[model samples]
Target: MSESKRMDPFTGEKVEVDGVYENEAGQEEELHRGDAFPADLILGNTEWKLTEMSFDNHHEGRTDERLVPKEKDIDKQGKIDSPRRQMDRGKK
Candidate 1:
């Protein structure tokens, strides 16, 4: 089977899932799949917030049973880290 992949938030590597990588500062960081995004991993230059999201639930009398909890943060439109901080995130 093809390996699943996700870009390392710190190094921008489209690495295979469950792999480990070194940062620009030579810090070893492990990668995983199926986990919530880490807000702290985002350097201090990005804007992120919880936007209301929902799913259609037709089985429970057409009522939405679960509003996604607020543990995850979605990036605000066009919000991104500055090049300087993006560089810092990869440093020791």
Candidate 2:
């Protein structure tokens, strides 16, 4: 048996592992866009070392202008915004 480790749902591009405990078995998964990645590793009890690791780019992040509502579109609570179109003056 070993101590439990906590990890963030999202992973960064870089990772630094400290040490592994004995009989440590776990699985780490990173989801991005429409892609799915699964990773499995067995941690050693000796020293802090990265045994089995992998990186996957799911590319699930995005910004859709259509999803954004206008100022008036939303109520006072700010839940939604109005869809009024605001025209910008032509400038050189």
Backbone clash count, each prediction separately: 0, 12
Residues 1-92 of candidate 1 have per-residue lDDT tens digits of 34355333433323334444444344444545443333335352222222222233454545342432233546433333344533345548
TM-score of 2: 0.19
Stretches off by above 4 angstroms in model 1 are: 1-16, 36-92
TM-scores, one per candidate: 0.23, 0.19
lDDT (Cα, tens digit) per residue for candidate 2, span 18-62: 222112244323333333222334332212223444333324545
Q: All candidates' lDDT scores? A: 0.38, 0.35
In model 1, the number of clashes is 0
Q: Which is the leading candidate under lDDT?
A: 1
Looking at model 1, residue 84 earns an lDDT score of 52
